[model samples]
Structures are given as C-alpha cells and as structure tokens.
Target: MKKLLILGLLFSTGLFQACTVNENPQPITNELLAEVFEVKADFTPGNSFRNYYNLSPVIFDSDVLLVYEFVGLDKTGADIWKPLPQIYTSDNGIHQYNFDFTKLDFSIFLDANFDRMRLNNSWRLGKTFRVVIVPGKFAKMVDKNNLQNVMNTLKLTESSVVDLTI
Candidate 1:
C-alpha cells in the first residue's frame, strides 16, 4: 500500500511538472490570417443576370470564399451583414442573393422563382457586400453561415476590411 501511494505521488508530480505555464504567454498569432473586403456595386442583370469581379491579389486554390450582403442598419445604426445565399419571399415570389468564386474572381447574382424582372430595380442597384477569404483549413473550424463567428475566428473587424468599388 505504501509503495502504491509513493508511485501515485511521483506520477502526479510528473504530470504537474509537465504542465508548465508560461510566465509571459505570447499572444497566438496566425501568419496566414483571413482577408476581408467590402464591395459596393450594382448588379446589372442583362442576358445572364450575373456580375463578376476580379480578386486583386489572387487567393490560393485551397482558400474558400464567403459572401455576405449588407441588409441594412441595426437599431444602433451599425451596419447589419447577413451571409448568403440569402432568400427572401416577396409578394411576387422567392428571390435569392448568392455568389460563386474561383481563385481569380467571384460573381454575384440574383435568382427568383418568379420572373426576376418583377423584382424591384432597387434590389439590383446600389448593393453592398462583404467578401471573406478564409483559408480552407480555418473554414472547417467555424460556422461558415455565421458572419460574426467567421469574423471572430478570423480576428477580423469592420475597420480591417478593404473597400472596393465595382
């Protein structure tokens, strides 16, 4: 019994020693952090009903793109962003806001169950969007549908976003 007690004590001590806390723990930093951009543009639905924009600095093939629409301002007057493909049911029918991206560029478009022309012209003009480029590995770790979750996980804020006009 005494031998067992000593063995357990030694094992506990070893475990405690192995878990050393750093006196001045360094802040965790990622060299390949995500990038964010705010794009303000108009979607001219001609024959195809799509508008494409080029990525200034080409992203990696493994990187994933998340696009959000600026719905409006909140009660606090802060901009409200919602992840796409967002769907809305109007009096006419259901309309959706969505996007697709490659390593070089991305396109945003509107689709509806009803005739898309029936939708208000305002829906296609003067639209704001937020684009997030996340590393493929990081995307798997967060709720991609949650803008706040992705922003927090990527350590990005509105101030850090680069603005582009299209």
Candidate 2:
C-alpha cells in the first residue's frame, strides 16, 4: 500500500509540474501586425515621371500593403479616404492613380490615356495618402477595398496613424 501511494503521489506531482504555466513569459511582439502611416506627395517633378517611396521599416514578404488617398471632404465636413487605383474622367482624359509595392518600397503614379503631363493639379499635387501594413495572417479576413472595413478589423483609428508626411 505504501509503495502504491508513493508512486501515485510522484505521478501526480509530475503531471502538475508539467501543466504549470510560465509566469514571467516574454511579451509576444509582432510590430508588423497592423501599422498605419499618413504620407503626403506633392508629385511635382515626379508627376512628370516615375517615383517610388520607400517604406521606413521594411515589411515581410508575407505582409500586405494597403494604400488610401484623401479625396475630399464630405457633406458632414468629415474627410473622405478612398482606396487607391482611383480613376478620374474629365476633358483632359481618363486619369488613374495607381500604386505598386514590394517588401522594401511602394510607389504611386499617374496613369492616363492622354498625356501624363496634362493631368490637373487636383489629381497630381498635394495628395495625402494612408498606407497600412497588415500582417499576412489577417490578409484573407480583411476587405482590402473598403477602407472602413480594414480600419475596423485592424482596430486602427486616426490616433494610431503615424504621420510620415512630416
């Protein structure tokens, strides 16, 4: 009986020790989880040609980049943010604001059916853009087209935005 009791106690002790959780665990840091940046482009000299903007902290190849351009104010006096690949039509021609990104950098350019130089200042100059870095883990869950949806899912707000424009 004594031998059995000792063996049972030993087994119980080992099991409990194995199940113990680490109390002073290191923090789980994923800096690229969801980061926001506000960038401004004048598109002066680059407007006539091609230009690329480098992302400050390089992102992982698995990460996703989302870009939004500030279009204008709404009726409620609130600023409107529109997703990129935006197209504009006017007398000048059909103009598009498109962008491409790699793990190291991202670039925005004006694409038009007409002369690129003919694009109006409104379409080229003084543009504010929001760049969001989302971890690839959440890529499938996010609606990339809807800015509001992306912001909501990532729990990001204007307060969380880092102003790279300055």
Candidate 3:
C-alpha cells in the first residue's frame, strides 16, 4: 500500500507539472478564426433544374433564396478553415460550394485529410421560405455518421428572413 501510494503521488505530481494552464490565455479573435463560406441557392423555376447536372440534384424547390454559412474548427475549438471571397453558382438549382482555404489570404489550422464541414449560419427570404439540411454524400466524410444528425445537433434549420430588392 505504501509503495502504491508513493508511485501514484509521484505520477500525479509530474502530470500536473507538465499540464500547466496558460497564465495569460490569448483570446481567439475573428482574425485568428477563418471566414465562413456562404452558399446561396436560388429556387427559380426555370433556372433551378439546370445547375443540377454538374454537381448534385435539387431535392427541394421554392420561390426563394436559401443561404448557408459554414467554417471549419479543430477539436479544441480553434478555427481551422478560411472562407472564400466569391460565391459559386450553378446553372441548375442543386448547387454545392465550399470554403476554399487555399484561396483565402490567411493561414489554415487543419490539413487536407480532415474534410469535416459544418453550417454555422443560415437564412431565407420569400413568401414562404423554409431552410433544411438534407443528408447527402458529405455525411460520410463528416465526423458524425449521419449528416442529418449533425444538422439536427447544430440546429441548422434555425433561420431568419431578410429583405431583398426585386
């Protein structure tokens, strides 16, 4: 018992010494974090079905614009991805885009292997607009098994209406 107690005490002391908290913890400012990419989808009847062939198909459609924002983060909550400046468009309604970290004029935290992406913000505007994140191929690459699960966990459906000029 005496030997065990001594060994445990020595191990604990060494562990505590090695893991010291930062006395002056640096704040994670917006500059340190990467910009979030904003994806916009226009649900116009004529043009909606056109852009679908190149990327993914448009599963749902309404007379509205659906916008979603997302950024990458590390396990410890550090920003790992940067947002791209220009928004991408598709001829068909079903369009997909990502935050190109390489194009952003900032340093990235995560490498290429970690393809996990998320929707941090979303919004819609129309007579009756509703935004939803449907499970797609991106789910398999996410940390969670289900893409819908991540959307539900993050509450991606929560959205706001914006005023737009016709």
Best by lDDT: 1
Weakest ten-residue segment in model 1 by summed lDDT? 40-49
In candidate 1, stretches whose alpha carbon ends up further than 4 angstroms from where it belongs are: 1-32
Residues 1-166, candidate 1: write the lDDT tens digits. Answer: 9999999999999999999787998765543558888887665556366778898688889899999999988899977888989999989989888999999999988888888877787887778899999987797898987777888899887787889876
lDDT of each: 0.84, 0.80, 0.31
Question: For every candidate structure, what is the RMSD over all alpha carbons to the true structure, in angstroms?
Answer: 8.0, 5.0, 17.9
Roughly what TM-score does model 2 have, to 2 decimal places? Answer: 0.76
Q: Summarize candidate 3's per-residue lDDT along 86-154 as a digit string, tens digits.
A: 143333222233221111121111112212122112311121111222233333433343323444443
* Lowest summed lDDT window (length 10), candidate 3: 101-110
Pick by TM-score: 1 or 2, better one: 2
Query: 77-145 in candidate 2: lDDT tens per residue?
Result: 987888888998899779878789999998877778987667767767778888888888888999998
The TM-score-based order of candidates, best leading, equals 2, 1, 3
- Count clashing pairs, candidate 3: 5
Per-residue lDDT, model 1, residue 122, is 82
* Cα RMSD for predicted model 1: 8.0
Highest TM-score scorer: 2
